[model samples]
Target: MPGFRLISFKRCPYVQRCVMILREKNVEYDIEYIDLSDRPDWFNELSPLGKVPVLEVTRDDGTKVVLFESAVINEYLDEVTPGSLLPDDPLERAHSRAWCVFGTALLSDAGDITMARDEETLAGDLERLGKKLDRLEREIDTGPFFLGAEVSLVDAAFVPALQRLAWANEFHPAMAIFEGHPKVARWWAALADRESVVNSAVPDLRQRYEAYVGRDRGGYRSLVGARIAA
Candidate 1:
């Protein structure tokens, strides 16, 4: 019934990014959860790339607009919404964007290494990720939120990654990296406490990840076991 539709996969980081932005902007939009294996034909027609977090804007007059990529969707929402997520101050905005990009990039790298389930590299990669968290802790001021006193797009963008990182640590005891960084732990805890992060999160990650891994040509143990043993 809403004017916008977000095509998303529940566990996808990119989709989480878009959801976070939409929630922060207080935008009303409908969400369609897509099965990656059996996507709806309509979605394929709209986005040939077949990626999730696609934003479809339908005007009252029946015009349709589609956008792919979480960053683009976030920018679009910021423009359309009355309140700004990125500050008007150029320097602050740049710093905020830098933090978002940094969190995403670090998490992506960590995911790649973790997904391999390699016994040797998992520890090292997790350590590197922990270092990034340490940096974030150093960068941020005292916060109930990321930009000092309030939640912003940067806070939303990074929170899901922190959630995943925590999951990684919980599943894989070897990734107890944040234990040393109290600030990082507090930041993550605070971020996770938000309504948007809570509402947007998908709790079936371990099962989905297990199924996805099972489908691979080279089979591995359940993600839970792999993490426990790794």
Candidate 2:
């Protein structure tokens, strides 16, 4: 509507990434919330996919840049802003960016696990998710953060995922996703404590997310003997 307007959904992790980037950059932007199940027509004009975290940049000259996809938007913001969300070395930057893709893939895998109807399907999806987590565990070194001290785009990319998996572990205590991932556990705990990550989503989110996951006609609620179902 003004300088910068971020179209968002109250609980989307992708939108949260953009929020974290905005907080990191200290950029003041307006936000308009929407329900994904019932999107407004104008939203289609803003995003081809009709998704949230769409940034509408209205420059002083009156031209506008409406951008979709959280990764692309955050990357553009880093270039325009003073500080870097990625590494200085080009190779390191590329590697970090690839992890960002992996982060999204992790989300997909988790969703597949969560929405899996059968024990067999859940087992397969869990293995896939576990393999991804193993890869993430292998990359760990010194970290109060994922890539090191200062929070990078990789950290931004993963804030949503880490929290969800943490909740998943909570919902079913026997299903500890972070088990044997000490470095990742440390990284997750630190990131969870950060002001940027804390304020990224709305309050009472844990309750809301838990309710959503356990809703009627669901797989998550079927936390039977199977660990993944749990």
Candidate 3:
């Protein structure tokens, strides 16, 4: 078996997804957290895109290979593990992959909401995010996980965004991110307590997240987050 090393940024949602997959597969690996603002030379050399969640694979033959991008790294991890997180059917697997892309868009929207500079910007961000959530609610046929009862790669992809949105909603209920989106809300509830999801990030992630988004960032959401943190 090849050994793995994951390069991560402490608060990156992308990195969190990789961590969740690693834990779900019960894969033993070493994770090195780096300061994204001051990335080390080794990381710069390993990551072509200069991104987090870079996977370093060391084969038994002593050859090393580097992989970047969360989605690709996740697929690689899933394929190497015992049971597959994707469906056996090709079309079903493609459908899951498409939704995984949607999950990344959702993550981007959540980031926009956190960094909105004014009420107008915040309102627009909320509207865009709400539309995506509505679409997700309709797309989900079954509850708990994205595809069904058992967790899939889709769940690992979506959970980080859902978790962050839930936190923002908690701090500012007016966001109403989950309001009227019962299916998506249920999905979030289901995965929120899973061991892999819970331990995907640092223990003080909430505090760290709040501080990042709210800390004198000059954004309207930051003001709200700052007030709540205080």
lDDT of 3 by residue, 75-148 (tens): 99999999999999999999999999999999999888877767788899999999999999999987768998
The TM-score measured for candidate 3 stands at 0.96
Tell me the deviation in Å of residue 185 in model 3: 0.8
Off by over 4 Å in 2: 218-230
lDDT tens per residue, model 1, 55-89 = 99998889888999887788888888887888899
lDDT against the true structure, per candidate, is 0.74, 0.81, 0.90
Q: Looking at model 3, which ten-residue stretch has the lowest summed lDDT?
A: 217-226
- Identify the superior model by TM-score, candidate 2 or candidate 3: 3
Q: Candidate 2: deviation at residue 219, Å? A: 9.8
Which has the better lDDT: candidate 2, or candidate 3?
3
Decreasing lDDT order of the candidates: 3, 2, 1
Clashing pairs in 3: none
Which regions in candidate 1 have their CA more than 4 angstroms from the true location?
203-217, 222-230
**TM-score winner among the candidates?**
3
Model 1 steric clash pairs: none
TM-score quality measure for candidate 1: 0.86
